[model samples]
Target chain A: MAKILDGKEVAAALKDELVAEVDRLRKQGITPGLCLVMAGSRPDSQSYINSAVKRCSSIGIDCRVKKLPEDVTQGDFLKIIDDLNTDPKINGIMVMRPLPQYISENTIKYKISPEKDVDCLNPINVSKVISGDDDGFAPCTPAAVIEILDYYGIKVEGKRTVVIGRSMVVGRPLAMMLLARNATVTICHTRTRNLAEETKKGEILIAAAGKAKMVTKDMVSNGAVVIDVGINFDESGKMCGDVDFDSVCPIASSITPVPGGVGAVTSTVLAKHVIEALKLQKGIY
Target chain B: MAKILDGKEVAAALKDELVAEVDRLRKQGITPGLCLVMAGSRPDSQSYINSAVKRCSSIGIDCRVKKLPEDVTQGDFLKIIDDLNTDPKINGIMVMRPLPQYISENTIKYKISPEKDVDCLNPINVSKVISGDDDGFAPCTPAAVIEILDYYGIKVEGKRTVVIGRSMVVGRPLAMMLLARNATVTICHTRTRNLAEETKKGEILIAAAGKAKMVTKDMVSNGAVVIDVGINFDESGKMCGDVDFDSVCPIASSITPVPGGVGAVTSTVLAKHVIEALKLQKGIY
Candidate 1:
């Protein structure tokens, strides 16, 4: 059986480091703060925010959620973001996505201050990510994957890393990050031909396609490090990742489980970004 | 022997399209204008500028070169850019890169207005490129590669495309563009292991590593479509691409030559971008 790349363990270690950093900032009378701006009461968004708030509290970071009405006008939504951008107390601002249909997503993304764009929604941050500049914040989920790799001491340099998605949030940014670390990165998606052949070539395979149990044993190479970034529900409504963990577990060198994997470490990564955001805002580093 | 992907043919075709478009805009008394900002008179920069000016004139574009002293201060350089940004007569602005060591390249890249960033130097344009949005212009060199492929009716969708290099101007953005068109894109660089192993898998191979004759016949697969984006002078001072053309040409189904391939189409791409910048600024389709 392959070794389980435990995300809970990685998150715990990261939280320990962040706790010390947060304590140092608190002693300096500077509390790292994060604000979650939501337009509506999306159940999924609410659950995500609740977990994020819980994680932030544990790390002693100030986390606040500003819930607006679903009918909030685009101007009002942007005004709220503008206010958050200038708020000294808020070092990081995360706008819950799939915002109202009427609201201009681009306007809100552009309105947020790049320094406080903890989720990296700003084009400036996105550009920095693409350019491999350390000044910008990468989205937490992808950063969490890196965190997991770092904690496990997996070398990315010169490795053939294949990412099975091209999302702005995960696959695309993650490919840039892996490439920045000197990995030869390939990005595959629904349009990719011979998906199995592509996945088999990866020494480090990342499944971010959001399809439950899409990756099977035949698709993965023997001894490949599989990082599953999918949060999908199987037919029985069981939370699962993109990889068919049971079949591939024995063939893989290491693999992360769905509930206990990337999803577990993501909130902690968000907390880490809040601290980084605070440092950037104050010019601490 | 492989069929040559003629760059002059692509350029001529593109020039015809742009000339018609430029004439239409000129009929409206709006001549698209471009400003080439250079800090010093580097011979290479001068040569590039001369060719750009000639191309712009051919396309009815008003191209101007702003030459500053070698020791131009950052403040003075920025001031010139600021002036050009608001100059209604100038629709596009391109700052010749490798600015004097004292001036911050980042600052200059950020200074150009996004609508007028014909070379896609601005982070906003880079972000748009990554996000697959059509609003921002891609750098002319990579854009030229696309123009050649489109002219030849080469299909990118579902193709296994490998890009050798991770340069901001060419390889990286080109991979994103290929990915945007639904190609399974892999980016390999100097740090990539088993380089031949990687290149052999590419149905479409793009060489932008800037090395003189690095890609050889053994590195390519039979019938692969090769796009050479390198412009290097060999030991004999003969202009050559990254590919060993004599060796790989026989093995490949189609290939682009360095001098008559990507380079020939680049200036035309710049002229096209100037027209695009004007249309964007004037809110014309």
Candidate 2:
């Protein structure tokens, strides 16, 4: 069996660092705070809220959840987002996505203040990431992936990395991030021919296909480090990753598990972003 | 002899379409307008300006030249950009780069309105590009290259595209644009090992290395389409491109000449952007 990349342990370490940072800021009369705006109470949104709130509590940072009914007007949603954006104590703002089909995500996204855009979903933040401007934050998940690799002493510089998806949330931005680190990155999607051949060439493989077990044992090379960003459901209704974990784990040099891997690091990265936002708000940066 | 891509011919066709569009917009009481902001009297800058003015005149759009001294302040440049942004006649704003070293580029970039950001150099516009939201203009040269290929009905879907260099103006954004078109894109920089090996895999090779005669005969696949974005000077003083034209042109299926290829189509795209920007201003789109 290969060495299991324990994401839960890594996340805990990150959270500890964030907690220490928060404490230091508290001494400086600054409280790192995050505001989550949930337009409708979907079960998945509620679950995420619970986990995020719990993490905030453990880190001793202020976490506020604003729940709007399903029938909330676009005007009302904007009002809540605007309030969080101006709230001097609120350092980060996250709007739980997949809002009512009628509501426009683009409208909400452009309205978020770039300084408080902790998720880095706003166009201004995304642009800053692309330009290497460093004025804004990268999305929590992609940022966590880079931080995880760096924390473990993995060198991305000049490595051949293959990202198996092209999503705004993960794959596309991850490729840009890897390229910024001097990696020779290849981004393959559904249109790509012979996906396995491409995956086998990766010194590092990042699977974010959103489909359960899309990457199998034959796709990865021996001694490759795999980062699984997909959270999916199996036939038995069990939460899983896009990687065929049981089959590929034995062949891989290192791998992150589904629930414990990227998912765990996300909330902590949000907390870190809050601290960073507070620093910016105070003009410390 | 292989059929050269004939970018000049392709660009002429596109200009014809643009002329019709400009006429239609003019009939609707919106004359397309472009404001060229040149910071200095550099010979290269003046040459580009003269050609752009000529294109705008031929396309039935109002072209205005805003020339400033090399020692102009960031504030003065921004004030001019703001004035143009507010002007009813000026629909697109392009600030030529390589401003005085004392002036901060970022300061001027942020001042240009996203709606009139025809150059797409500003962070706001860059962010829009990253999000795949065409809210603002794309930089002229890259957009021109894409339009040239699209005009020829060349297929980008599933093709292996190798882009040399990573300049934000060309290589980086162009790579993203190609990926958006479903091409399996690889971006190689100075740090990449075996540059020729990477170049050989490209079904479509984009050379933007800013180094004259970098892509030699041995580095290309037979019958590949080549788009050279470089405008570097050869050893004897004449302008050349990243591709070693003499050696590779005979073997390649299609190629763009440095002076008349991508550069020739650039201003026409800027004119197109002006029309688009007017539409945005009028809420037509």
Candidate 3:
């Protein structure tokens, strides 16, 4: 059976470090602050924000949520961003995804201050990630993957790593991160021909395709390290990942469970970004 | 024998299109203008700039070179960029790389306005390339590779493409471009183990490792399309590509030659960006 790479363990360890960092800053009369901006009352967004707020509070960081009306005009939405951009109290800012249809995503992405962009929505931060700038903030989800790998002592250098997705949020960014670590990285997507053939070649396989149980045991090689980034509900309503865990676990060397895997660590990564953003704002680094 | 993918042919075809575009803009009382900024007189940089100027002139676009001293201060260098940023006459700006030791390349990269960054040095442009934004400018070398593929009707979709090298200017950007087109892209570098094993799987192979004739017959699969992005002088001072042309040519289906391949098309791609920059400035698009 594959050894379980526990996300909770990794997140707890990270939280401990962040807690100390926050305490140090607080003693210096500085409290790291994060602001969550949401245009509409999306249940998903609300749930995510709630958890993020709780996470920040636990780490001794100040967290705020700005719940705007569903009918907020683009100009009004941008005005809020502008206010937060200059607000000394706010160290990091995260605007919830899938904003109201009327608001321009592009405008908001550009308007957010790069120094305060904890979620890395700003193109400047995104550019920094691509250019392998260590100082720039990476999106929370992708950063969580790297954190997990580091915690588990998985050496990425010279490894044949396969990422099965091409999203800006996860797959592509993760590939860039892995490449920076000297891994031979291959990116596969829905359009990939002979998917099984490609997946089997990876010493480290990452599935972020968002399809539950899409990766069967046949797709994975024995003793390969499998990282499932997918969060989906199987037909019976059980939370699952892209990999068919039951079958693949017996053959794989390691794997992360869906609920306790990447999902569990994402909010903590957000909290970590808040602290980094604070340091950037105060020139502490 | 593999068909020779002639770079001059592709460049000539692109030049024809650019010539017509420039003529149309000129008739509208607007001449597209590009400014080339160089810090010192590096012979290599001078040669590149000279060819670019000649190409721009041939395409009926105004090209100006700003030559600075070897010991130019960062403040003075940035002042020049600041002036060009607001200059109404210049629509596109390219700062020659390998600036003086006193100037920070990062500072210069960030200083150039995204609207005028024809060479895509600005991180904003790099971010756009990563995000698959079609509106943003791509680096000339990578864009030229895509242009050559398009000109030859070599479909990238669903192809297994391998890129050797991860430089921001070439491999990484080209991988992103290919991924955007639905191709599965694997990035291999110096740290990659079993390099030949990984490369042989690619139906489309790109060599950008800057090593002369590193790719041998055993490294490529039969009938694969090979593109050499290297511009190196072998021991005999003969210009060559990353591929061992004599050995691999018989088995490969198609290949791009060094002197007449990617090198021949890079300058033309720069000229295309000038037109694009002009259109963006005038809001013509």
Top candidate on lDDT is 1
Model 3 TM-score relative to the real fold: 0.99
The Cα local distance difference test for each model comes to 0.95, 0.85, 0.94
lDDT against true structure, model 3: 0.94
In the range B94-168, model 1's lDDT, one tens digit per residue, is 998878887998999899999999999999999999999998999999999999999999999999999999999
Question: For candidate 3, lDDT tens digit of each residue in B211-238?
Answer: 9999999999999999999999999999
Model 1 misplaced stretches (Cα beyond 4 Å) = none
Candidate 2 lDDT, B1-285, residue by residue in tens: 445666678778878988998888878877878888898788888888898899888999898999999888877877898899899888888887777765788788878888888889778788666656667677888898898789778888888888998888998888888888888888888888778988888889999989999999999999898999999999899998899999998988888888788887887887788878888988885
Q: List the residue pairs that clash in candidate 2.
A: none
> Compared with the real two-chain complex, what DockQ does model 2 have?
0.73
Residue A234 CA displacement from its true place in model 3, Å: 1.5
Per-candidate total of colliding backbone pairs: 0, 0, 0
Candidate number of the best TM-score: 1
| Proportion of native contacts present in model 1 | 0.95
